[model samples]
Target chain A: MADMIQIEHLKKCFGDLCAVNDLSFRVKEGELFAFLGVNGAGKSTTINIICGQLKKDGGNVKICETDLDKEPDLIKRSLGVVFQGSVLDKDLTVKDNLESRAALYGIHGTKFKERLSELARLLDFEDLLRRPVGKLSGGQKRRIDIARALLHKPKILILDEPTTGLDPQTRTLLWGVVEKLRKQENLTVFLTTHYMEEAADADFVIILDHGKIAAEGTPLTLKNTYTGDFITLYGVSEDDIKKLGKPYERIRDAFRVSVPDTHAATELIIKNPDMFRDYEITKGKMDDVFLAVTGKSIGITGGEQ
Target chain B: MNELFALTKRNTKLYFKDKGMFFSSLITPVILLVLYSTFLKKVYDDSFRSALLAAGADISDSVLNGCVGGQLVSSLLAVSCVTVAFCSNLLMIKDKTSGAIHDLTITPVRFGVLGFSYYLSTLFSTLIVSFCAALVSLLYLAVVGWYLTAADVALLILDVFLLTMFGTALSSCINFFLTTDGQASAVGTIVSAGYGFICGAYMPISNFGNGLKNVLSFLPGTYGTSLLRNHFLRGTFAEMKNQGFPNEVVEAIRESVDCNLEFFGTKVEIGAMYLIICASILLLIGIYITMNIIAGKKRK
Candidate 1:
């Protein structure tokens, strides 16, 4: 696929502190791209620069084959951004909030009505249209915010920690909307999230630490490079576990052994059938990949600990 | 242009929908008018009637009282226009804090267009409130047998429009410096409290000492009050002119009630006053636009 967004040597600083430094990345068309990082890792800074909300100190950014610095308004028109903050006015009703944003985009009259109704149907908030935004639940508000951003039918959607405060069920439903939009419109999604599971499903994932790219690859590839396979055995005694010269955990009568690959993990469990009454093998997780790359857990800094 | 209009419409809808905002822009002014008519009317009538009688112009009680009421009503018009327009700047601050300004900036709407739309919205809302206040005063004037011709009403509208434009522009320029809640509240309180005094709405400018009056000459409300008073009391002043009163006495009463603003010991002619109001609005817009552009360049 063609690249939808391209950044070259992007750098931003605030006084003595560098917010984004010597970073570069490309988001392909119709790709579900994930930007993963701890707090202050420059995900939002980079997003702001691309969205034309903040000026960059140094960099060249091209969105949809147009230079961002030269034609920022043109580029902004093609990009829809839903930042963590709820930009919708709480005092205005759901429909009024959307209508206000629509007016800014120059979508009014029958066209605004049409687009609003379509979004209402898609987000399943038709009944909540007349209700004030402040009265809505967090999940409902998030959905409305997304609907507001997408009203202009932007080709690339930027979501910054969109599902942070959402419930698990709402998160699933929101992602379902994203998936449907992607398949139907071939939308390019650039998402920043702390949820490793959410990043795990992206077509491309990039991890940032201290304003630089620490890891960049597909979820499966990163997992393979950074994570280890594991085997768990039930009804295994300490003496029987000690027979193996590998690290093992004793939980009641069960033992878990870590290995390099699935073959090695399964081979160990098969070789110890008499020691294990029952056994299971499992693959590594995405957070393991994140830990390997950033050397810190999500949202936890070295100084914080 | 269409985008600006749409944004203006949106703000209008929001302003009208909010009951609290309606009261601030409309009801408060009407209530002030009622208080002015009932409580302040007698005091002003007694003082001004005695002053006119002392000026050697034998005037009927009702006509002399009309002059006082007209002056007070016009001064109220100017002060309320400025106060309500300042209140309208709250919408811009709300947009900023709510992050909707960022939301709009990310679209094709430039800051100039957005700012212009906000000003237009403020202008429209101020006019609505000012109109209500004018109606209350005009209705009272009618009860006292002091009626306005249609041309006089037209002149009154023109005066209100210019006053509102000046008020909106001045408020927009000053509000650029307000960011925090403390700053906004402080500015709001100061404008609400000081505008009336400075504009001679609470007390006639003739009562001010030379030093204080000289300082007030720079405030827009002073000129705005003078302009509005001239239009609103045009008929009453004309009647004074036709009653065979000497030109000196008519001018004296006009000066006493702030129907004419003074500059360097000279009365500002109506044409010059209009020019000053228009010129001030233009200068403020120039400053506001240039300020935004510099701020934009700094960001870029």
Candidate 2:
């Protein structure tokens, strides 16, 4: 796949504090990529610099192989951004906000109508266009924001913490919409999220810590490398498990043993058949990989599923 | 560009749709008009007529008092328009609060579109308020037999438009300097209270002299007040003349009330005043743009 976005030697500082430090990364085309970080990890700063909302101190940024410094307006034209906060004019009706945003992008007439229709179908917000954005639910407002960004049919979409404050059902629904867009339109989505489970759905994940990339890989690979699978045996005696010499921790009524892979899980289950009545194998979670790489736990942990 | 127009349209819609703001802009001007009609007009007219009578001019009480009262009341209306226009600039704090401005800055739209659209919307709101005030004053003048010719009426409208544009430009500059909605509101109050007194909108500039009058002459808003008074009161001057009042005495009153602005000890031509006003508006706009560029470079 072609590199849709490339950044090298990026640096940003605010007074004495460095916000982003010599960051380097590439976002491949037609892929859902997730950027993970704790607070103040420079995720939004990098995004802002790329979008030309803020000037960078030192860096080379390219969008689809076009140097961002040479063709900033061109890069902006090819990208759609749903910023961290609500960008919609809450006092204006959803339709009015969309129409105005479309006009700013020079999208009009038949093309605008067609795009609005398609977005209405895709986002399931056809009936709520006339309502004021301030009166809408959080999920509904987010949908309008996404629909507004998609009006220009951008080649790349950047959603910065798009589902940060939404309900679980709404987050799932939004992810579903994004998945559909990824499959149907081959949209290159670059998103920042604290939800490790949400990052698991991405084609690639990069965890940032202290203005630098801490880890980067496919989600499954990162999970397998950083996190261990757990084999929990119910109704097992701690002394009976001592013979195997595998490290064990008694969790509630079960004796839990951590293993490197599923092969170890199968071997342990067969050997411990008499030692335990029932056994369960649990896959590793993404946060374990995040915690292992960053060494700092994130505070945003409500409804992360 | 189409983007500029679109943003202007959106801002205008958001402003007028705000019921609290729309009605709030009207309240002070309407109350001022009511006070002028019922209570203040007679006192001003009687005082001016008695002074004229004491001078042995023997001018008709109706004509002389009408001239004085009409000029004062309409000047109030024009100044009130500017005050409301100043209030309207507070609408921008919403954009910053909602983070809509951040969304706008990232787009492919030209920088001029983002800034000028705001100025244009402010211009629209100021014009609407001032124009309505002018119409009400015109209607009152006509009822009192101080009718203006069609050309004079057109000139009056032009003055209102220009005054409001000046107000819009000044208010836009002020709005850009403020970061919080509370600051904008405080600015609105400060302008409402302080600007009128200095610009000769609340009182005749002739009441002050020496350095104070000279200082007032340099303010851009002082030009707007002078423009509005000259346009709205020209008919009153003609009415007093037609009533067979002595030319010199009526001229003296016009000069005292500042029917024209003086620059560096010379009477400024109406055309020159317009040019100065236009230049000032453009200069302020240039400053606003420059500030935005500087801030966008240095800060978020």
Candidate 3:
């Protein structure tokens, strides 16, 4: 895949504090790329710089092979960014807001109408086009925001914490729509989200810590590299597990033993079939991988599926 | 250019759509008119009568009414055009507070086009409301006594247009420093209340002490009010001349109503006043554009 977004030594600073420090990454075309970080970890700053909303101190950024410094307006045409905060005018209806935003992109007449209708249908916000943006619920507004972002038919969609405060059902529905759009449009989705499970579905993930790339890999690869799989025995005593010469911890009523991988877990279970009759094996979660890499808990447990 | 017009149209629509903003811009002038009629009318009448008595000439009530009405209309317009601008230009601050500007800046639209769209919208909205106020003033003038010629009415419109341009440019410059709704409102309130006094709209500049008059002379808005006063009261001045009143008395009426504002000890000519207002508008617009450019460079 061609590199849709290329960042080399991207740096941004505010006074004495460095917001994005020597950050470098690339997102491939038609890839679901996740950028994960805790608060003040430079996620928003990086996204803003890429969207040409902020100036970087030093960097070479290319979007779809267009130099950011030389042709920022040209680069902007390829990017559809959904900011963390609401940008719609409260007094304007959803249709007016979208139409005005579309005008900024030079989308007009039948092209605007067709694009708006397509996004409305795709994002399940067709009914909300005439309602005032301020009157809509959060989920409804989120759908409208997504529709506005897609109105220009941009190739790269940058979602900055797009589902931060949404309900579970709404988040699931939003992700489903995003997945569908990704498939249909061949979109290179650059996402920053707090939900580990959302990042888990990405083709590649980058974990940022204190303005640095702490870790980067596929979801499964990061999990296997940073975290260990677990095997829980319902009736095994701690001493019996100690006798097995494996590290073990006591759960509510089970002995949980950790292993390097699913292969090790299955091997141990098969070797002690009598002791592991009532046992369940689980793979490491993205949450665990995140915790291991950043050494800080995200506090929302995404259990194994 | 099409994008610019689209955004400008949307912005103008947004201004009128907000009930508080739209009504406030219109009501401010009406309120000023009412206050002037209720309290200031007698002050102006008494001053005119005394001027006539001292001159040993008795002007007819019809011509006296025309003169007083001209002062009323000129002061109302001079103040309202500016205050209405402060209200209409709130759309810029609204965009900033709502983060709508963020969405706009990220688009492919150039900053120059975006900025010009905002300026055009402010100019159009302010002009619409100010013209409506001008109509009301004209109606009031018709009711009191119609002394203005077709040329006078035409010149009054030209004055309104020039004042609106100055007000829009001044408001845009001030609003560049404002970001929040509270700040914008506070500034709006201050301008709406304090501007009339500063421009000598609420009272004659001749009534103010010489020290203050000298200070007011430096502001272009002072000249703006003088320009409007010249057009609005020219018909009455000519009437006084026809009624066999002396030039010094006509000049006294001019001085009393701020038609002949003195810069330092030298009296400013009517043509020079227009030049000053035009220059101030250009200066204000230049300042606003420079601020945007500096801010844009900082962002880059």
* Per-prediction share of native contacts kept: 0.65, 0.70, 0.72
Chain B TM per candidate, please? Answer: 0.91, 0.92, 0.96
lDDT (10s digit) by residue, model 1, range A136-249 = 999999999999889999999999998887899889989999999999999999999878888999999999988899999999888878888877887667787788777877
Model 1 chain B: weakest 10-residue lDDT segment is B291-300
| lDDT, candidate 1, at B95 | 74
> Candidate 3: which stretches are off by over 4 Å?
A234-255, A299-305, B208-214, B264-267
Q: Give candidate 2 misplaced runs (Cα > 4 Å).
A: A242-253, A260-273, A301-305, B59-61, B145-147, B289-300
DockQ of predicted model 2: 0.60
- Predictions ranked by lDDT, top down? 3, 1, 2
lDDT of 2 by residue, B160-260 (tens): 77777777778887888777878877888888888778888767787787678788878877777777677667777787777786888778777877776
* i-RMS for every candidate: 2.0, 2.3, 1.1
Clashing pairs in 1: none
lDDT by residue (tens digit), candidate 1, B1-300 = 788887887777767776776776665576668878788888888887787678767887667767877877887787888887887666777677777778877887777777777788888888888777778778877777584689888888888888888888988888876766567667877887888898888887888999988888877668778877877777887887887878898888787778878886987888888888889999998887677667665555
Query: Measured with DockQ on alpha carbons, how good is candidate 1?
Result: 0.54
Residue-by-residue lDDT tens digits, candidate 3, B133-235: 8998999889887888999899889999999999999999899889999999899999999999999888878999989988988888988888888888888
TM-score per model over all chains? 0.92, 0.93, 0.94
Interface RMSD of 2: 2.3
> Candidate 3 on A61-99: residue-level lDDT in tens?
999998999888898899998888778888889999999
Point out the higher-scoring one by TM-score: 2 or 3: 3
lDDT of 1: 0.82
